[model samples]
Target: MSNGKKILIVEDDSAIAEIERDYLEIDGFEVQIVDNGPAGIERGASGEFNLILLDVMLPGADGFAVCRKLRETVDVPILMVTARQEDIDKIRGLGLGADDYIVKPFSPSELVARVKANLAQYERLRNRGGAPKDGSELKVGQIAIRPQSRRVYVRGEELTLKNKEYELLLFLVEHVDMVLSKETLYERIWGYDAIGDSATVAVHINRLRDKIEENPGDPKVIQTVWGAGYRFKA
Candidate 1:
C-alpha cells in the first residue's frame, strides 16, 4: 500500500538508523541508510529516494548543511531528526528546508507516523495531475505563484520552495489581504489532524520571506499583522 516509495535515512548512530529502517520497511517502504553528513548528501542528491530522514549531528556536515545542500538540488521532502529541543534549532532546521522534524527519544510509532504523513503529502502533490489549479496562477508584484505546477518566480527567475513552503505561500495568496491567524493556517494547510505546532507556520513564513522578499527582515508581500496573523497584500 506504500506505492513503492523509497526513503533515505541519514544517521550517524547505527542502532537508531537500523530501528528507523526496520519500522519503515515494515510499513512497506523501501529504505536506505547512510551514516554521517557527506554520505547523506551524496545519496540525497542522487535522486534515488522519495524522502529523507536526516540527523542533526553528523561527522561531516550536520543535518542543517545536508538539508540546505539537498534543497538546492532536490525538491523531495526532508525530515530532520535531533535530540535538541531548542526552538532555535527546530526553527533553523525548518528554515533550511526540512519538511518536518522529530525530536529524539520519540516512539517508533510516532516516527512511522511522521514518515507516512510526509510521504502521503508529497504523493498528493505529485499525483495531482492536471486537476484544476483552483486559483491556478497568482501574481503579486514581482512574485508569481503557479499553483497548478507548484512553481514560484521572482522577477522572471524561478525560486525553489519546499513542500510546506509552497503550500503556505499559496494559501496566503489565495486569502489575498485577509489576515490569516497562525492557528487557522496550521489547520488549513497541515490539516486538523496534524501535529498542530504554530512554530511550523512561523518557520515556513520566514523561509518564504527569505525567498521572495528583497529584505527578509522587513517583508513586503507576506506581511505580519502584529498579534493578528499574516496577510498577502496583493
Candidate 2:
C-alpha cells in the first residue's frame, strides 16, 4: 500500500515555499522545503519525495540543473514553477525532465488541484500490473517498451525513463504511424489541455528522442510531421 505522499518544495523565496507547504500539508501530504538548487538535488537523491515542486529561478544552480541531476537518480514527478511566462522557459523546464509547469502568481487552489491530479495519475500507474510474458513488446527498431512494467529497452539494455517520459513514449508507440497533435497529446497525458504554450510537447519529444533514438538529430522511431505533430514509425 502507498504511504502518505511526500512532496519536496524547491523555492528560494521563503514566502512562496511556506504557502505551498502549508496548503499541501493541510491536504495530508508531508512537505519538505529547500531553498537552493544544489540542496534540492541532494535531498532529492535521497529518494524520499513522491513529488517535487521546483522553482525556476533559484540560488546556486537553477531549477533546470537541479531537475536534470535529479532525473539521473529518481523518477519522482517534478512540477516546475516560474515567474517567467515565456514559452521558451517552459520548454526548457520540460526538456530538463520536469513533468509539469506552473507560472507565478498562480492560484493556490489550482496548484493544489494540479498536485492532486498528478499524484492520482502516478498512483494509478504504480498499481498497474507487470509486463506481458508474450513477445508483444512495443518495438521501434532498436528500442523496445514494456508498458506494464514501465520499462524501456534499447538494444536489449534497460533504459531509465522518468514517469512522464515513459508514458509519452508508450503513447506514441501505441499510436504508431499516426501523427498526433500536441494539443491532443497534452490533454491525454496531462489530463488537461496545456494552456499558455505548446512547446512543452516539443521539449518532451526532443528529450524522448535523445534517449530512444540512435541519432537524435534525425529521429526515426518518433518522427515529427512538420505542420502536424509526431508519430512512431515502427
Candidate 3:
C-alpha cells in the first residue's frame, strides 16, 4: 500500500547520498537528494515528501538543528543517519523528534530496513484511527494523552515524545492501575518476544518519567513495582 512513497535524502556527502537514493528508488520510493542542511530544512518545511532521510553531519547547519527546525513545521517521519554511534547521540536524535536513527557506515540493506519499518509504523498509526474523534483529551490526573495526534501532556504541558516512547506510554495508560511486567510490555509494544531486559524498560520508563513525573527520581505517574514491573497511577 506504501509503494512509490516519496523520500527526501539530506546528506552532504555526494557518494553516500547517491547510494541511499539508489537503494530507496530500487525499493519503489521516489527519492530526492539535498546536500546541505539549510536546503533540506527548506524542502522539509514544504512538506513535499512522505519521509526524510537526514544526515547528522551536514554543511551549514547540523542534522539535529535541521530536525528540530523541521519538527516545528511538519509531522512527517524523519530517520536520522550519523557516523556517531554513541548512545548519547542516539538519545539526542530521538529527543529532537526523529522517528528513528541509524549510524553511518551502516549496510545499505539495514538503512532500507529501518526506512521500511518506520514508514510501516507511521502508516499503521495514521490509518488505525488512533486519535480522538470528539477532541476530548484522555487524562489520568496530571498526565494526558491524545491518541489521535500521538501526543502526551504532563500537567497540561505538551511532552515531546519519540515514536517508541509514545507507544510505551499509551500502552501503560490503556492499562492504568494494572501492573504490567517488563516482558509483557516489551512483547506487546515491540510486537515480538523479548529477552526480558529490564534495562530496556527502565530507559523508556525513565524517559517517560522525565516528562510526566514531577520528579523523575521520585516518580508518581508511572510507579515501579519491585520484583514485578510498572504501573500507571492516576
Candidate 4:
C-alpha cells in the first residue's frame, strides 16, 4: 500500500505504536514513532511525512491540541486514534481537521487499511488527480483550478483552500452536475468513515463553498440537494 512513504505515529503507548510500525513497515512504508504530542507536532509539520497516526491521549499536548496546531500549517492526512466511544470525541476530532478516527482496539489490518486509504487520497490530491495530466486549468462557473500547481481561483482572485476543502472541490468539479450522495462523496473523498458520520463532508463542503462561492450563505456553485447530497452546479 506504500512505496517508502513515511508515516509518523504519535502514540504514547509503546505497544500500540510498535504494532502500528511493524504493520506499516511490512507494507513498504517508513514509520517514525513519537511518544508525545509536542514531538509529533514538530515532526509532523516538517513536511517529511505523507500521513500521521495520532493518539488522542498523549503527554504534553493531547491529540486535539496537536491536531489543531498541525492544521494551522500542515495539510497531510491525520488519522486520530482514540479509545473513547463517545460521538463527541469523534466529532471533535473531525471538526479539528482530523481526516479519520480509529477507535482503540481496532484490528491491525483495519488500521493498515485506513492508513493506506488516507495516504492514497493524499497522493491523489498531491499528484493533481493522479491522471496523466495535461497541466490544464479546470474552469467551473467563476472558479478555476490549476491542476499543475493545485491552486484554486475565484473570479480571477486567488483563494487559499485547506487540504480537505480543495480535495472536496476538485472531486465535485471533476464530476460536475452529477448528484452525488453523501455516502459516495464521503467514501470517494475521505476513504474511510470510522465514526460512520458524514458531518466532516458537510463541514468541508461548507468550507469549500465559503472559499469559492460568491456568497456562502446562498451557495450557487455547490448546490445542496435536500434529502440527498450535493452537486457542483458550476
Candidate 5:
C-alpha cells in the first residue's frame, strides 16, 4: 500500500520520532528520521522527501532556525513538532515558512492526519502550478495571483509568500466580500479544525496584509469584519 511518498522526521527524541514514523508508515508513507537540525538541513535540502516533521527543540539548531534554512532551498512542506503551546512559538514557526504544526502529546492518528493534510494540500498546489501558461490570473484591487506560476504580486511588485500565507490570500480573494471566520479559514487552509488556533489565522492574515496591502496597519483590501472574521474587498 505504500504510495512511494517519503517523509523526513527531524527529532532528537527517539520515542516520539518512532511514534510519528510508525503512524505515517501505517498510512503508507516512507519515513526517515534525523535526530538534529544540521543533519536535517542536509537531508531536507536534498529534496528527496515529500514532507518533513521538524522538532522545535534540537541540539545543533532549533526548529525555527532549521525551518528557516530549509525553506531557503526546499519547498517541501515542513511541519513543526513542538511541546510549546505558546502563541509566539507558533507565530514564529508559521512565519518562518513552516507549512503547519503538530503539538506534542498529540494523538498519533492526529499526527498522521496532519501529515496527510499537509501533503495532500501541497500536491494540490503543485498540480495547480503545473497548469498551462494561459491559466486564469486573478486580480483584485492591486493584488494579482498567477496560479500557474504560483506567484503573487501587489501593485506590480512581486511578493514572497510562504505556503499558508499564499493559500490564505488566494482563498480570501476567491471568496471576495465574504467574511471568513478564523475557524473556517484555519480548517480550509491548514486542513483541519482539531488544531484550531486563532493565532494561526491572525498570523497568516497579518503576513498577507503586510505583503499585499498598501498599509498593513490599517488595511483596505483585506479588512476585518469586526466580530465576524476577514473579507477580501474586491
Candidate 6:
C-alpha cells in the first residue's frame, strides 16, 4: 500500500538527483526532481508529494530556507541531503523541520531505506485519527498525548509539534523513566541503523524539551541521564 508514494527531490546536482531518483523509482516510489530551491519550494507547497528529498545548497534559496518555507505551507516529511556532516548543519536542518538528514557519500540502499521508513511513518500518523480503544492517553506529568488523534497538549494547552518531534516524544513517554541511549533511540525512531552519529536524536530531544519542558535550559520533564541518555520523568 505504501509503494508508489510520490517523492520530490530538490537537488541541484543533476547526476546526484538522477541517481537518487533512479534508486527510489526502482524501489517502487514515484519520484520527481527539481534542480533549484525556488522550484522545489513551489512544488512542495502544492502538497502533491508524500515526502521531499532536499539538497542543502541550491540556487534560489538554499535548503534551509526552502525547508523553513515548506514547513510553513506543508506538513510532509522533509529529508535534507548534504555533503556537510557538521553537527551544526544537522541541528539547523532538523530545527527547520526536516524529518531526517543524509550526508554525502551515502549508499543508495540507505537512501531508499530512509525514504521508505519516513513515508511509512508519515502514513501511519496520517491514518491514526480514530479514538483509542479504551480511551487511553499517553501522559507524562503535565503533558498529555492522544495517540489516536495525534494531538498533544501541555499543561492543558495544545502545543504544535512537527512529525519527528511527536514521534520522539511518544517513544520517550512509552518508556518513561528508562534511560535510552542515543543509538537505541535513533534506531527505534528512525527505523534504521545509525549511518553516522546520533546527533539527529539529540537535536530532536532538545526540540521536544523546548516545547514541553517548563525550562528548556533546565529540563525537568525530560532529564539527561549523564552519559546514559534521556529519560522522560513521569
Clash pairs of candidate 2?
none
Any idea what lDDT model 6 has? 0.87
C-alpha positional error of residue 182 in candidate 1 after TM-score superposition, expressed in Å: 2.0
lDDT of each: 0.85, 0.83, 0.81, 0.86, 0.87, 0.87
Q: How close is candidate 4 to the true structure, as a TM-score?
A: 0.86
Q: Give lDDT tens digits, candidate 3, residues 86-113.
A: 7777777777777667777888888887
Task: Tell me, by TM-score, which candidate is best.
Answer: 5
Which sections of candidate 1 miss by over 4 Å?
129-136, 140-142, 155-157, 191-194
TM value for model 3: 0.78
lDDT (10s digit) by residue, model 2, range 159-181:
98777777777778778899998
Clashes of 1: 0
- Per-prediction TM-score: 0.85, 0.85, 0.78, 0.86, 0.95, 0.93
> What lDDT tens digits, residue by residue, belong to model 5 across residues 1-234?
898999999999999889888888988999999999899999999999999999999989999999999999898899998999788898899889888887788999888888888888877667755335678788888888888887888889999887778778888988999989988998888887676778878888988887877889999998999898999999
Q: Candidate 6: where is the Cα deviation over 4 Å?
A: 127-131, 194-196
**How well is each residue in 163-222 modelled by candidate 1, as lDDT tens digits?**
888778777877889999888887666653456777888989888898888899988888
Clashes in predicted model 3: 1
Error of 6 at 84 (Å): 1.3
Model 5 has an lDDT value of: 0.87
Ranked by lDDT, the better of candidates 1 and 2 is 1
Error of 4 at 234 (Å): 2.6
- Evaluated against the true structure, the overall lDDT of model 2 is 0.83
lDDT-best of 2 and 5: 5
Please give the ranking of all candidate structures by TM-score, highest first, separated by commas.
5, 6, 4, 1, 2, 3
